[model samples]
Target: MIDTRRLRTLRAVADHRTVTAAAAALHLTPSAVSQQLVALEHEVGHRLLERDGRGVRLTAVGRILLGHTNEVLAQLERAGADIAAYTAGTAGEVKVASFATAIGLVVAPAMDTLRDKEPGIQVRVLDAEGDQSLTMVLDGAVDVAVAVEYRGAPGEDDLRLFRIPLYSEPFDIVLPRDHPLAAVPDHDGEAAPAPERDAEMPPTPEHDARTAPVDTSPASTHDPRALPVDTPPTPERDTRTLPVDTPPTPERDTRTLPVDTPPTSERGTRTLSVADLSGEIWIGPYPGNPCHDVIALACEHAGFTPEFAHSSDDFSAVVALAAAGAGVAMVPRLALRGTDLSGVVIRPVPGPKRRVFAAVRRGAERHPLLIPLLHALQDAATALRQAPSM
Candidate 1:
């Protein structure tokens, strides 16, 4: 019989594309990973990997074996889930991996619910990006993962995993409060009507933008006024003046703006198109982040590439950068919830929406911890859907 551990090592090598990376991810030495691969090949009586310049590539037999390995691993996962269900104990530790925002918007709330309802079950949360989280789930390093759909993410019907969709959220353009594009002009030259704000509430404080700490309390009932564009400008304020020409300071001009990009004009309306942001400097996620690809694709569709002046993996930091007048940003709506918007103006842009999902190794969907956890996520998503947008 093929050793499951060796098969796992093979999968890791294939997924990471390098033995060194695979070893790191598996928390094993490079020699150990190589030894496992050698053992796997001997057991199967086939050479599974071949040197491809600096890296190794899977042989034809290796690809065929991998397909079977995925099936066997998935079956093993299902068998474990079935046994756990049959044993009927609610006590177990479930490790969940997710991006920063989902931890705030979904996982944290679900954990709160689970704590109240099933104290016996312990949940461990790890902050990870979509692709990394999914890989962790497949590797059994995590019991489940909360991930977003991206260009290279696994399809919904992938046999090796089960995906339970949670929610879909559109990206919003965040601008500085003092930005010329923050408000639209009224028909008679007065400011456009502002979205209603709760006068009794105080402004949320600007916290460190790098971390999104989970708030266990229910979402605040008090809704802030929608993008406030109603404040009339003074006589000296020309609503049409663009901030783009503000001299590029060392801190602000991190990257050169695309040559063909147009300059921002004060002439646009409240409703924004992707094309309208062509000239603006952007604050975005670093390369390989799912949001980074979404932003890039959205810009490509709109006819220009975003000129990223600042890059951060943290959505909070991205928003903070925009609020500080560094650049505009496209942020996921869920990330914006419960965030401080004191100096920010959020407006909808026609672009890609992120689809969030709960992923597990195939057949683990019905595990006791996962079932209730899934329900809690659904409840949170429903509540957010019903609640008014920030």
Candidate 2:
């Protein structure tokens, strides 16, 4: 193969069309340029130049090599331009893999900033989860993956992995307006179960499923009792024969007034607790879906195993299910944007979240634009984390 430097010399000679001129362009002697060109010709196994008076002219083979060399040189120059632009934080394309939440709450906003400020740099986004995104980055499928890392999650920093700390979103519990709990007090000492009427409750089945209207009324927020179903009294047993050793009881005075009975509290009007919701239907992205971790945590946090009524990967489906009272679901704040789920409520949960990270191939540390993008991501993450509404 021809040495790169020798190729450079040949290209210069071709461009100048004279040994002396080419040597001057390359800061080399005419003899040195001729020698390098000769060496390149030998490596290609053919004569690259034709004899002419004073200087030399390119042969057909020489022209072909020059064509290829020109392309290579152009590519190198483009790469250099990309490098300069990246270092200045103003050019090159950034390939990114982002989770649904990050795409909206973080990536979208960052994209606007990148477009306005660094017009020369283009950004491409792929919607993906943290694990898959990281894998894609490590395999060179993406330049950077916006991954989450919950507290106590694993790490890859020692393997050339880097990360930016992004914002943390607290969970919320969604409830209807007339929910018995709404009538109850909040975390503050104030009384809950805000005084509301049955009209605020979700439309109760006069008993049909499909025609259900928007349940403007909230379910009781506090522990509400289930309406009791009358059970048939057990058949009374007949004891016709008395055993010979049976003892008799003493009789009481016939006319004594019966003690006043204590009045009973209303059972069906109380708020339903988590345990009372065992049979409630639920909705989610999919079975065992990672995005639903917070939903599961919320259910477990609320002291019940969530009864999922339907499953789908589409965010819209989850929202739809929640709208129909199929069951409550956990959704990224970004995914919830612009969606009107009039009856669905957002509730906060404690100690529940997902974690993510930024990943790239093992040897990509030296990539010309990779470093710049990584730094930008880190800075953006810091700003996002410190911003309000996290």
Candidate 3:
């Protein structure tokens, strides 16, 4: 029988394409990784690796073994999950990997809820992006991964994984409060008027016009004429028209737009088009990050390529850079929640959206701890969906 650990080492080398890289990911010494590969070749009775220049390439026999290794590993995962489900207690740790913002938006809140409700189940979280986290889950390094949909992610029908969708959040344009596009035209340098304490401001005609569908194809440029510069002000209706102790109307409690959608602006409020930002420097994620791809694709759709002058994987840092007047940024709504917005104004933009999901190896969905964790995440997502815009 082949050793699973040696098979794992072989798979890691295949994924990373280099012994040194696979060694780093597996937390094994380069010599140890090499030893494992050698031992596995002897067990299999076939040569697996061939040195090409400084790197190694898998032989035809090695590729065949890798295919079986993937199936065997997936089967082992399912077996483990089944065993865990049937076990008496939920006292073990469930390792999780996720992007930075999701730690606050979903995982943290779920952990808080679980603290009192299921103290026996401890959750371990590691900061990782969508693709990396998924890879970790597949490799058994993590039990679950909270990830966002991005290019090259596995499809829904992928038999090797199970996915639970949490939410879909739109990207928002984050700019310095003092930026030319953020100011109300007629108000000059004065701050925009604040909404009344107990009133909901109705959407203006200009807002309606701005929300109209636009061509988002890669070859299209946002038409400047499509943006609304002036709109007639609508009267603010009092939300507290009922008796002091009366229950609020459903309209007052329901959200008509996303929780992070910008509030309706009054007359003379200027809507910005992507073309207007063509010359400004951008702050975004580094090249390997999923958000970086999303931003790049959105820019391509807008008929311009952004000059990314500052890059950070941390959304807070991106926002901070924009707030400091370093450059503008495009960020997911959840990333901005509870962040310091003192020098920034976040506005809605018609662009790409990210769909967040919780992923596990196939057949691990019913693990005892995972069920409660999923409930906690769902509760948090529902609350966040109903929350008012910041």
Candidate 4:
């Protein structure tokens, strides 16, 4: 067996044309380089070099061995490069579990970015609820889970998983386009029509303030937190396991109520209190969905209990119902961005917001395959924050 280290020394000596020069290149003494060449000749049973005056020159057999050494060294360099790239998280398939609209707003955009930036990474997306994605990550079923800040998700300090907060989005109220509040002045507390926007176009904060997503950008001056974006004001949720069950919040009365009469104080505003809607019918998410607890909790905090008269996990369906005048619905602003709002109006309050984040197993956050994907997901989230809802 030939020693690779000796072969490298032989190559360096050949190129440098002298053992002393090769020693300098290899950071070794001239005597050390000579010893390695001698060891190489012994390994192959050939006289690899001979003294040609003051300098050393390769023998016929030495030339033959040098050629093979060149090939071997080239391959070794190639192997080194490939291993480096593999460890850098620049190439591989990453499985991601996310809800649908996030697939559109965050996942899809992230996919485009990955395609351009790290084509070696293939991202497989699963359409899942926030809770489902959280479980998938913990069970090692997926490389990452893009989930909402729901009731059962692991906390940032949870030992079982690592969480990366990507962005926060406000929940918007869905109302029939003709709903009296739609005619009330917008969030500026003045009567005005919001500028229309296509789902693909970026939206301004002024429009989102009326009935869409609030800009959560670091550069944005709008203070979304100033509004109550969470229910229960300041409650702690246990996050050690999926589907955490706490004390039951009082069930909201979801029965049909006549909202036919516009408020006598029909002054338009950007924010609404859950108490104000206690008398109106409500459409909410079903129990298994991540958004369910948030909606229930937010209302409970506002001194009222609200429930789902109509429950569905699909925000599009929830919006459709609200458009049909079935009932009012609470929707994450991102979910509303891509849905048809022809007959619906969103009512945004200074209240509850859903936090979007990416999760990976305890130590997997640093996995090469996950690094780029996580970055792409985060960038997508930041872009979504700048985008307004319908």
Q: Which model, 1 or 4, shows the larger TM-score?
A: 1
Count of clashes in candidate 2: 50
Candidates arranged by TM-score, highest first: 1, 3, 4, 2
lDDT of 2 by residue, 271-380 (tens): 23444345466666654445566566656767888877677767666765665655655554435545554555443333344443455443343344554454445445
- The global C-alpha lDDT for each of the candidates, from Candidate 1 onward, is 0.69, 0.50, 0.68, 0.64
State residue 356's C-alpha deviation in candidate 2, in Å. 4.7
User: Which candidate tops lDDT?
Assistant: 1
Best by TM-score: 1
lDDT of 3 at 360: 79
Error of 3 at 81 (Å): 1.9
Q: What is the lDDT of residue 50 in candidate 4?
A: 87
TM per model?
0.77, 0.48, 0.73, 0.59
Query: In model 4, what is the error at residue 138, expressed in angstroms?
Result: 0.9
Per-residue lDDT of 314 in model 1:
82
Better of 1 and 2 by lDDT: 1
Candidate 1 vs candidate 2: the TM-score winner is 1
**After superposition, which runs of candidate 3 have C-alpha atoms over 4 Å from their true positions?**
42-47, 50-54, 57-61, 129-132, 157-160, 183-275, 388-390
In model 1, where do residues sit more than 4 Å from their true spots? 186-190, 193-269, 388-390
